[model samples]
Target: MLVNQIDTRQGTNSTPEFSHGNTLPYTGIPFGMNYFIPQTTFDNTSWSFSPMSHQFAGIKITHQPSPWIGDFSDFIVSAITGDIDLKADVTNQMGSYRPDAATFNPHYLSIYDQRYETKTQVAPTTYGALLKYTFDEINPKIIIHIPKNGSFILNENKNEIKLLIKNYDSHFNDDFKSYASLKFSNKFISTLITHQDNPKYDSMILSFNNIDELLIRLATSFISYDQAHFALKRLTNLNFESAKKTAQETWQYYLDLISVSDYNTIKMSTFYHCLYRTFLFPQRCFELDSNNNPIHYDLYNDKVKKGYLYMNNGFWDTSKTVYPLFAILIPKEYHQMLLGFYNSYLESGYLPKWLAPDERGMMPGTLIDAVIADAAIKGILTKSEIRNFLKAMLKSANQESHDTRLGRMGMKDFNNYGYLPSDKYSESVNQTLDYAYSDFCISQVAKLLYEDKIAQKYSHSALNYQNLFDPKTGLMRPKDSSGNFKSDFNAIRWGTDYTEGSSWQNSFSVYHDINGLKKLYQNPNFIQTLLKLSNQKPAFKVGGYGFQIHEMTEMVAIDFGQIAISNQPSFHLPYLFEYTDHPEYTELLIKQLVNQFDDTMNGFPGDEDNGSMSAWFIFSCLGFYPVCPGSDEYVFGIPIFNKATIHLPNGKQFNIKTNRNCPQNQFVQKRMLNDQPLKSRSLKYVQIINGGNLDTELCLLPYSKENIELPFSLSN
Candidate 1:
């Protein structure tokens, strides 16, 4: 099965000095609440699980979507033999393990601790994990380190351990809490829960004797200990192999959705791993009850609510490709996730921008509007529910929440000045452009719901990006409150008014109105501007970032000019060439990017950021991309493989075949969808979901841009 082929550590080999892709070696089911990973190092704070590290701290139960967001509700479990050292904490009590020799996969993990002479194997379930420890020595022991500020109690009669964790790094207003129940096969010879003078670092250590082998079953919950026990009972019967098989089967069910047949094994493997990453986020936080009803703990209300809830997703990273990819392969889950997002809105009174457990309000704009509109436009949601979705979209667009972190940062400023002022917010230019795109999304949803008046208003408001576009530089420059462009403009300077990117990367982000943006500098100049962006050196001036940020480092690491395909801001850049006279340049750039990724420790170009980068790879390899979500059209690109067969949700298959498909023959010559020629370099969303064959002729020579229909634009 394809699931067995995935390494899960494809992009996690990173360090403070250099980062390839800051991904975790997560072993779990798709969208599982808890991911099991070997904590390679306890050094450098949040940068714990490094693929290159030789030391094994323990196996961690992590809900960390990204290192930037940090992990919460996380705990470490380690097995040891011989004499016990009570004074040794997690940092001091580490063992050396060969990272190269360790077994790492999506379903199971096995690591040999050289110091303790113990071999540990871990298998994952949705809410819990099964751990088997085999020690070479007579005295076998286990240590469980709960996060600081968390409490745990061990029951001798029930042979169960219950834990509650309240420690989160940068959290929202919610009283973030996590519960867990751990069951062991052997009797606990001795157990101690101790508090140190530090108070911040406390642990529960359990010791077992005579037994060389022990089995540990664990379950986690966000609601209560009862919920945790409920989860533990559901999976208590599962053994290591059984649990691994179950998790593998769950992953195979999703991985089988898209099958690629290519002569290149490594490339195909990379594609499958990227495909795997796309499904591992926006985890279902709700658990099934005795009646099999989904229920989740609502943090806002401080109560357990009976419904579906999803967390650990940031819309800023996922809105571009992840949701669109789901709309294609897993529409049913997509619908449920949309419902889950709506549930988040119902609880928090606003749609979330970033969520670990609740609203983090990171990034810019309410981009969930884009996800909703994309779903609505694709007709994924039922007619009965479109109104509710539209209401949520409008609420985000119009109603300003009292907390700036909950809604748009500068909603009132955008409404009053038509754009956010540079002085008010850090990334005002990004906020303005993102808000404009989201407004367009809101308008699309409103249109779908037959709210014509609402649609028209948002449609006009969507053009707010025009206010920030400086005609002189032909870039979306930051502007002051008095309507003057920020005087000092350097396109390659990173951050101030832009979010994690320079003006060169952020300017052409008017995905909704590409043609309108092109008109600001005329078509020819627009083409020249795009050429300059691609042809220029990848050099950057730190600007607001006094030192080099990781983004700057990533861009410079690759020789892809100013097109930082490593980040989401530059994701649509390759597609932007279609708006110009050089459509083949877009194809060439995409091929360059698609080549950068492979099934290795350095698989991704940058931080996967909850599958955004993975989704980019999946879409690019499939030969089309959703450049603008909320719009039905998918912009065309060069396909990497010979053939790709997508399993659509309606029991149909959408097949893409490429002829003369080789490394050198990278450019497309002709394209046909369902045996009919497509004049445009794009496909409708309906065409893909309805299921059909798309055949393309590719050769060594680039296709001529002349007389070719361009990708969809607002002016078109």
Candidate 2:
């Protein structure tokens, strides 16, 4: 359960509104599933940390502690019994859970949470009839009085308790369905049974689709059957008034960020999706508990653990897309996240590549420089806190011992030099290039924060990536000391010098400078460059479609899998349209990418490094991307939705909308703001700050017109 306020009301117009991103907040309130999988139960699942709503804690879950509850088991069986001296023939259709049926026995059910125990389970004396105690107090003494025909019933002017049964079916592992029924007091049903098991698979499948309907049916059943009586309002928010009020308010907050005027559906979707994407990464580590002590884990291992241990990270790649998205749309959370990262630096020497506090270590390139630098610029973390950490990392970058066993350069010195000097198993060229890029990110932050000297030093360091650029070859070739290409420089095959990708993916890796790279070639060209790269075809296939390989494996060419999308620095590639005047091509790539991949269970189409992979989908869907973070502007592109609402960093909303259908509307047919023609191609910082409506109409045909945004200028 990740979200609510989605108008779950069983009304004539209740088509159930939902956030359409890969990840959305899990309203703690149960929706599709029978039980609420808790935040502590969070994992790196799907798109976000928990794949749940941040307000999940606010949603009340009926805590029923009984032997019938089952998890990671064979099946669920109601342990109810009737002392009516009745004769009955009960089929075993309600399959077995455990061989001994004691796995979920009351006493053994490890108190997943103590709050549930205090709320639901009580002494048999506290409820009604009494029976036998368990082997110790593990078993309950409450007796379910049944009719002569072997049916269960219960109710009184007493313990206002409702009853519900979740028949965990065989499809539990696959399609995520549960066969559940409810009742109030069991007094009205002639069967005298609380809930009967069903072997019918069709009914169970039907029950899963109308999730909201099922919830109402179950709730209504409680009162209708009188087998168990309870009100949905008896719990969360007390009533719909309170819930809807909160939901609308939350919607308003996100809408204000990407303030689109004449709201079309596509613009609305983008804005909201971007807002949703920002929260997907470092999830709700802070959840209120029974005592309300904020019982969530930390993201960066912060002091109070205020932000839970949010451990998904792809340092270099994320710094480019994910972190910048946070910096613009949600700086406060971004601040907290950076603080947590610094904490991780203190705890774990040399920050981390892809890190978890418990060390789920992913890949290499200690690119915390980007985060630290940006944090300093954005005032997210103090310079004093990060300075020492960055300095301390130089040793690992330049002189640290390398271990080929670890899948990185064979020697430590290789990381800092931008090239390994005389190491047999060093990815020297790639290391140097990556190190320089990270320095560029760090420099931007220092430059912004009046640390001119520090920024310049790092900026110069960034230029080191150019050293690998071979003039004759016009590629980022591997070089030896006196400037000679590595002997086994097989541009055709990958070797110890390069990472998983070949020169095609790595050549233009120096993104900070297309011009400098242009100088490296005899003829400067973007289209030719892209066309050539596209034609090269992966020697073994790097990322997405056709031939998939074991992700993160050290294969020569097989790239596209789950982790590649999650990892690589391929995000800003599409926006090259702005620089190259190939906006059409950009639209082509984006449309193909979006239509191809979705929130599937087979991981992401590739490695979704933290939320970087998710961020790409988010920004593209929203019709623009943060081509240059801290620039107060996002490079515009064809949006995939009719509407999108962006939740900006300053707690305001911005909207983007187009003609009804989004992905289908690929061209910018007409555009307006509060019904005015958009004279400027770009949507500026001031416009978003004003918080108004932005309306756009998209077309299926290309306009073949040049409507470039305020030509991208270098901050320098």
TM for every model, in the order presented, reads 0.97, 0.57
lDDT of 1 at 167: 74
Expressed as tens digits, the lDDT of each residue in 1-716 for candidate 1 is 36767888898877654567888889988988888889876543567787777988789889888888888888888887777666755577788899878888888899999999999999899889899999887677787776667787888663678888877754444467889999998887787776644324567778876887888899999888898999999986688889988888888889899989999888888888888889899887988898999899888878888889999999988999999999898888889888888889998888888988788788888898889888988888898778897887778767888887787766778899999999777889999999999989888887877788988998899999999887777788888899888887888888888988899999988889898888889544888888888889999999897888888888899888889988899999999887766788877888878888988888877888899999999999999999999899999988888999998878999999999988887688889989998788789999998899999999788767687787777767
Worst 10-residue lDDT window, candidate 2: 205-214
Error of 2 at 98 (Å): 19
Evaluate residue 531 in candidate 2 and report its C-alpha lDDT on the 0 to 100 scale.
51
Best by lDDT: 1
> For residues 105-214, could you state the per-residue lDDT of candidate 2 as single tens digits?
11112111121111111111100111111111121112221111122223353222233323222221221211122222212222323322232111110001111110
Model 1 deviation from native, Cα RMSD in Å? 1.7
Please report how far candidate 1 places residue 60 from its true position, in Å: 0.4
* Segments in model 2 whose C-alpha atoms lie over 4 Å from true places: 1-280, 283-310, 359-361, 375-418, 421-425, 471-474, 487-496, 535-548, 551-567, 599-604, 628-633, 649-651, 659-716
